[model samples]
Target: MRASPADIESICLSLPEVELGISWGDRPTYKVPRGAKGRGFLLYRAPGKTAIDPVSGDMFTDLLVIQVADEMTKRTLVQDPQSPFFTIDHFNGYNAVLVQESRLGELERDQLVEIIADAWATKAPPRLVREYFANR
Candidate 1:
């Protein structure tokens, strides 16, 4: 039931018009095509100063940044103690959550899929969103 990086990539790319791009530090970012550029919905984060482990003071190397529909959703996810979703000060106002890949085992595969799909919907073109749901 645990999700892997491959599962994340597969679930993301399965959505309509999703594209893969390299982000800062050469991290893999998943986005939905919109116009001249795509809007990123998910990203594999490189270890940085802002997201260090409180216990070890070490940068987290396995972080995944997943976009949410809004700030409310971001707060809801990160506030839930049982949820694997979290956030750092760097994302104080951003509509996204950080999940360590190592902690992905806390979530079921279906949950992972749904999360990625929702992320896609938030950034996917409106026409694409309507069409995708209409066909489903």
Candidate 2:
């Protein structure tokens, strides 16, 4: 089933104090402001079951090491007392949640199957992904 624009809007508004926008991928992304640098989050949408379907938003990611620009900042994120996801600074405050352990159950298997089909289509025609975004 195709997702309605209203469906997308509902998801964005459900987030707490979120600022949403369409990213380069032509999918929804969000910016969450925090008191400190690199304390942001991305409301990223990844490929879904259908070539046109998109996964729901319900995941968070910590920074990775390689993404850190300087040694001091890297140490700060890694050593932060309230650190959630280790190596979070590596993401530079930009990460997407396409997979997670749902309380409901394992990931929706159907969702994965459709995503692969869409990915294959993209590989077969690079412009297809871009066009998909444009349509969204």
Candidate 3:
């Protein structure tokens, strides 16, 4: 029941103006335009050598990096032991959290949907945000 890459892609693309791109020409990344700039809100990030996966004694191949509204939100999510969110030293003070693919089953689909929507809203332009909220 773990969330798959297909789930992430569909959710991200469902948001207005989100585009599929690659991180370093490999990992999938989802971004939204902010004025003339494109901002990435959700990205597929693999654990680096600095962050070892305790279960495999190696780096994790499927970590999802999701942008949050602020550091407080990031801290709150990662600090909750029941939450599947986590972070590494590389993301210290960053306004994002990492969720492993294997642990996605711990979250319901609606939970993932809400997270994706919130992540998009956080990176979207003010005009887009206004339109999105107005339509809701």
The candidate that wins on lDDT is 1
The reply for model 3, stretches above 4 Å from the true place, is: 1-5, 24-26, 34-36
Tens digits of lDDT, candidate 2, 2-49 = 332234334333433334545445654443321122122333334332
**TM-score sort, best first:** 1, 3, 2
Per-prediction TM-score: 0.92, 0.24, 0.87
Q: Flag clash pairs in model 2.
A: 30-43, 49-114, 62-88, 63-87, 63-88, 63-89, 63-90, 64-90, 64-91
Which 10 consecutive positions of candidate 2 have the poorest summed lDDT?
A: 95-104
| TM-score quality measure for candidate 3 | 0.87
Report clashes for each candidate as comma-separated counts: 0, 9, 0
For model 1, residues 53-103, the per-residue Cα lDDT tens digits are 988989999999999999998988888998989999999888899999988
- The parts of candidate 1 lying over 4 Å away from their true place are 34-36
lDDT against the true structure, per candidate, is: 0.87, 0.33, 0.82
Model 3 scores what on Cα lDDT? 0.82
Candidate 1 lDDT score at position 14: 85
Q: How high a TM-score does candidate 1 get?
A: 0.92
Candidate 2 Cα errors over 4 Å, as ranges: 1-19, 31-41, 45-71, 88-136
